[model samples]
Target: METTKWLLDPAHSELTFKIKHLMISNVSGAFKNFSAKAETEGMDFSKANINLTAEMNSISTNNEQRDAHLRNSDFFEVEKFPQLKFTSTQIEQTDDESFNLHGNLTMKGITKPVKLTMEFNGIMKDPYGQEKAGFLVSGKINRSDWGINMNVALETGGLMLGEDVRIQCEVQFVRQGINVPVEV
Candidate 1:
């Protein structure tokens, strides 16, 4: 079996998360710098090995003050942990297009097993004749599990930030072999 490698198409890939703020509305954020790669046997992604990493310092919420607070000791502690990572341990096909992706997520020096849903958006050839694949990954995790338990008590009797964080990513990968330059 020939091994197939997939390189992340950074321009079309995004890592974003949302959490309830003020116990009322959701706050969205994204990691501006992140990367993912996968290896499979002849494009069989069912058993592919996937790895992803996001730079802590690249986190943004569209608000500098909030973003800075998230990067500090009250949350991610970017100075101590520069990156968070995820490595797939297993992938179970739930159907022809959906799968259960189980992996170990490491953040803030803590590692935890996480299960995420992945929807394979099929593969196609780009205008440059490069093979490309797309996927949508979604999941939720408790922030406190990784030591990001910062929050302020509201007068209304609820925490300022929600504990559960919803993660969503639209990732595109270009099959290696074609040397065509990807134009975002």
Candidate 2:
């Protein structure tokens, strides 16, 4: 068996999240700058070591005002905590194509263990003859767990924002030694 490395294909990957707003609607946001990498033994993802990081300053919700608020001290505090990171601790295969990814997510200087579901989309050779792997990862976390406790009290007897944040990411990775030209 040989050790294989995979680098994130940033141009083909995205990290997005959804949160309830005003207890009625969902607000969507994404981190424009992020990266991930994986190391596996002979392409066995079950034994892979994965790491990921996202630039806090790249967080965007489409609306500048809301985005700015999220970056302030009331939320992520991008100035003090410039990046959020995750390092996989364990991976348990649940089915033929699905697995439970356990890792420690660090944000706002706080670290917490989290479990996420990962769907392995298999590996294929691209038009450029490069080996690429895809995955869909998703999970939910409480905003307050990372000390992001900012919220408004709606006069209607409900909180403005929900504590639960739904994370969804579609990521693609290119095997090391593959010369695939990527825009970003």
Candidate 3:
């Protein structure tokens, strides 16, 4: 068929990010509650529409104290703004398998443009005969723009946390027959 919804297969998909911690190795984490949707046929991304959301309280670094701090008023203020969201405004084709997705990202009550580089991995049919599509997306965002800067002075050098955040996403979509909801 020529129509399908690229439903985010959360079981296999991931929304991860990394940032500099104390001028040393990067600290990585993923948003466990997030979703994205897009529509694509055999060879075009013209009608692609995608949206993503992350529950601020779901931030986890495998450290309970750190996770709590992230949910506090200093970082995410999870009680005040419980979610971060992104909605695609436009998807432009850059190549046969690549695309530039420009969208509005809302975090901590601020909104800004975040561009995501995307690659169409491929389409396949599962054992149950359900058609599926896969994609890989990555991008970098400066946390300062979204008012997420939290840091402290290091006795030896730079701040505790860096400004730039690297994000990566691996998503798989099953055909709309799975009862996927469309974002208007």
The candidate maximizing TM-score is 1
- TM values, all candidates: 0.98, 0.97, 0.89
Q: By TM-score, highest first, what's the ranking?
A: 1, 2, 3
Tens digit per residue, CA lDDT, model 1, 1-184: 9999998999889999999999999999999999999999998999999999999999999999999999999999999999999999999999999999999999999999999999999999988888999999999999999999989999989999999999999999989987887664
Stretches off by above 4 angstroms in model 2 are 179-184
Score residue 143 of candidate 3 by CA lDDT.
Answer: 92
Better of 1 and 3 by TM-score: 1
Worst 10 contiguous positions by lDDT, candidate 2: 175-184
User: Which numbered prediction scores highest in lDDT against the true structure?
Assistant: 1
- lDDT winner, 2 or 3: 2
Clashing pairs in 3: none
Model 2, TM vs. native: 0.97
Residue 168, candidate 3: Cα error in Å is 0.5
Quickly count the clashes in candidate 1: 0
The CA lDDT at 154 in model 2 is 89
Q: Note the Cα lDDT for every prediction shown.
A: 0.95, 0.95, 0.82
Please provide, for model 3 over 1-184, each residue's C-alpha lDDT reduced to its tens digit, 9 standing for 90 to 100.
4765566777778888899988788998878888777765643555576787888878878888988988997888999999999888998888888989899999999999989898988878776666677888899999989888778999997799989999888888767665434322
